[model samples]
Target: MSRIVSLTASVFAIGLFAGSAVAAGDTITIGIPVGLSGANSVVAPSVVQASELAVDEINAKGGILGKKVVLEVADDASGAAGAQKAYDLLIFKKKVDAIVAMETSAARNAGLPIVNRGKIPYIYTSFYEGRSCNPYMYINAWVPEQQVAPIVDYFNKQGAKTFFLIGSDYAFGRGMLAFTKEYIEKNGGKVVGDEYAPMDATDWTAVLAKVKAVNPDAIITSTAGGAPNVTLTKQLRAAGIKALYGNLAVDEGTARSMGADAEGIYIAGSYFTNIDTPANKSFLAAVEKKFGNDLKTPNELSVPQYEAILAYKAAVEKAGTTEAAKVVPALAEVSVEGPRGTIAMSKQRHAPLTMYLGQVKADGSVSIISSFKDVDPGEQCPKLK
Candidate 1:
């Protein structure tokens, strides 16, 4: 919105921009360290837009605590190295009061120490491997517990006895599949193929060949969100291997981008563009009015970003200050009704999400098969609260 304000090349050979109704230093700064490049680039625009809408709405309503909100966005590049660079500039240089990010787990890990060192509250808006603990951080997104069971259980019920697992060679990929494998077996299904590929690798020929070798009843993939999902799905379709397809990381936007390749790939998520609730309907209207044709479909990854921004505002109002020490504690105690529902991150630094099991239709829209309400995040950082 406002052209994303170009980032200076010196910031990582890229310029940085800030959008605030109030003057620079006079507003509440929310640093969004997201994947503007690399694999997550495809979905980053939606997250940024979500943040913009929340900030704009808050400002329109007289701003937060009488100060407008500003966003300082940096490209994490969807990895540790880029995240380290992004975090350094946003925290140490920009001196942002808080961070609300929807980035890969690797990026989150790379940036958390910097966020903590900067003494700022961090709202990790990514659905991830789970159990990532930090005194200054609260997760307003789904974990493996809320995500895994839906797809796996549906396949099991449909008589899928054997499953194949594949993912990117990273913490998120490995961790998600690991949890999925455990859950599959626990539910009386067998994992036939388990493998991984490098996140940046586009060629899945070898991986596909391996997958073909097993010819399992179900093939589940957990790749890096944006590009990997595109490449792997396309390759899977090209390979002509017919098996029950499921993807743990494909969002509504990414799936749509994949076009026909994403068809029939089952997935589970916390938000869909069609969730019928007054709050979600209003949010959708606002998003449409703001973006129109340019709107990147808001899905699970982005919906939380919008809601988390509101939650952050509530935390600040409750804490009486923007200081991380005070605000961090209030983060989990506040609730925001948005794209999903009443989302409160009170369950051990994580939120209990209402999950949906769906399959990608020919139009790239997900058809909800079953819905699980208030699914527990399950044992994530019990020692925190």
Candidate 2:
């Protein structure tokens, strides 16, 4: 944590992101508040890379609304307490016009009220537990409807009648699995055991013991995104639990980093490197060229960060101003086609996402198994209008 803090201070001091917005003196500042330490640390680099690529591209072609754009980044350290500090530094101190972030659900929840008070356009770029609504906020990531259904439905088809559930015991972990449990029960599947550990719990021996005893046909986990995902998956493999494994929260980059431990496990997502679309190809090339060896693998968690920044730009263009009230509504009215396909958020304050069911290979690559297009985020703040 200290080393990360030092690195952040050095970047800011060196004027790394001080762009033409400085010389122009007329700029729209967009703050990126993401986790640089703790559970989200493993996935935050991908978000940072995607954000840098999108911002550089946007700035290259004139800036947003004829004003140069500047990005101010602060690390939330992956929890509620850290989020408050990150939000305060960006919102009150820097006075950014907008925020584009892919943060943990706890961090998002903690920072949202501050963003509202500051009255900036906030674009949340994480696939989360859902149902978070604010007048000035919009989300471009998957919810339970888009992400969980494919996994449950596919497992059911594979004759996975009995299952066990495990999670990080947080809002995202419990919330997603709650929906999974309901979905399983509704689909006539049975759950033998359901367990949750703390968000930061690294040791899963006891959890595996409980999981192993059930002997269910399948096991699904929803740990906190980065470190917990790695820890639990590694331990699950080491313990040789062997029931069919599925993850609701692991991103492609983390999955790949797990090596053999992640092989044969299943996940549902919105984007992958092998998307084979012109937009995705172009985006990937730009990121690779810009960051080169430092680039983290782009995945569902980070792709939406890039898209959200673009979508925010579109909303500002559509609204003809950066005022939160106007841009907020315009956000739902606009669309951005990026690596994940075209994303058109709804008046309900959520997007209709395209979902993919993928299985991780021995080398950490995910192979697509099935796809569902334009899945609606059901009833997420329907009264937002």
Candidate 3:
């Protein structure tokens, strides 16, 4: 199997590919596989921009290990096949030293085998289902425990006893809801309604009607990404159910896009554009300076991409090499100060971050209402061998 894999990689390297001639040690290439076009496109720009910001900062500081950092971007098209193809290109053709990815679980799962085969250090920068254990993979985003538990606790404390749950019919959505149900029940709350919609679902009339009928004390939604999230929020507001809406998938950028519809919605995550820390303020100012009037509001979903790149830089510098074997162990000890705070990678290859709970104000900006400091990922991934 190893011989066959090597032959295939050799063939790909010699084939007609744009970046196939890229030599190792010349530059530290970080591949970014994201939904540049498709259902997830709404948030993709922010992901790319944040990553670029990190690269610029690192390069300006004399690069990492005296080698300039560069990005090799590939469009995942919001699908599993696209992700697999993008990963193959990055690993076999472009020969990127590391990968910073933001995609759905299906896409990530599809690309995992390729990552394992190539032994490249892959940083998954997206809020996802718990327990994604892989030898060559690291997660820099919130897992279920870091994201759901705090929100559930906050809702329960606020007298939200009966909750309605809705999400896209996918691994991430279903898995998140499962954790949410457990947290709600553990907190002495009941799930009044549990439902799901397709990834591209646009109309929420039926779901809204059912939600009104259930009349839950709070509505917890994880509708996939982009248009689906916006559609669900808009329809919920149109229905005027008046129940507290707790959104696990809505980020600051998406909330701003929702405008008046986003008002009063609840969200919990590691970063928000309006977070009042000096580090956060400096990060936001840097973004504004780089992108100027074209800057999009940074969100929890996108900021992790920036943090992931920085984490990789720190690990590589500490390890004194970009080889996956050396960097993988160094990653466990690497710490980077992000907009959220000082985040360090755990032994399980996930970051422990500070979580914040906020409500979208009338102007579509988040108002921090509660904060959970230094929340550990407590990941279920098996220890790397």
Instruction: Please identify which of the two predictions, 2 or 3, would achieve the higher TM-score against the true structure.
Output: 2
lDDT of 2 by residue, 1-385 (tens): 0011122344332223665337645788889898888899888877876787788888899989898777887889999999999999999988888999899889999998999799998999999988988888889998888899889888998999999999988899999999999999999999899999998899999989998888889999998899999999999889878788889999988888888999998999999887778988988888878766556788888899999999999999999998887898898889998988898887488988778899999988899998888888898997778
TM for every model, in the order presented, reads: 0.95, 0.95, 0.92
Off by over 4 Å in 3: 1-24
* Tens digit per residue, CA lDDT, model 3, 1-385: 0001011222222212323454666678888888876667778777877888898899899889988788887888877889989999989987889888989887899899999888999889898887888988888888888888767877787889999999999888899999999888877999988989888789888888889998999999987767688999998988888988899988888788887999998889888887888998999889888766567678887888998999999999999999999998888888888887887768478877788889999987899988888788884676664
RMSD of 1: 3.3
**Residue 381 of model 3, lDDT score:** 76
Lowest lDDT sum, 10 consecutive residues, model 1, at 1-10
Clashes of each: 8, 0, 0
**Which 10-residue span in candidate 3 carries the lowest summed lDDT?**
1-10
Candidate 2 positional error at 168, Å:
0.8
Error of 1 at 134 (Å): 0.4
Clashing pairs in 1: 7-14, 7-15, 7-16, 8-14, 8-15, 8-16, 9-13, 9-14
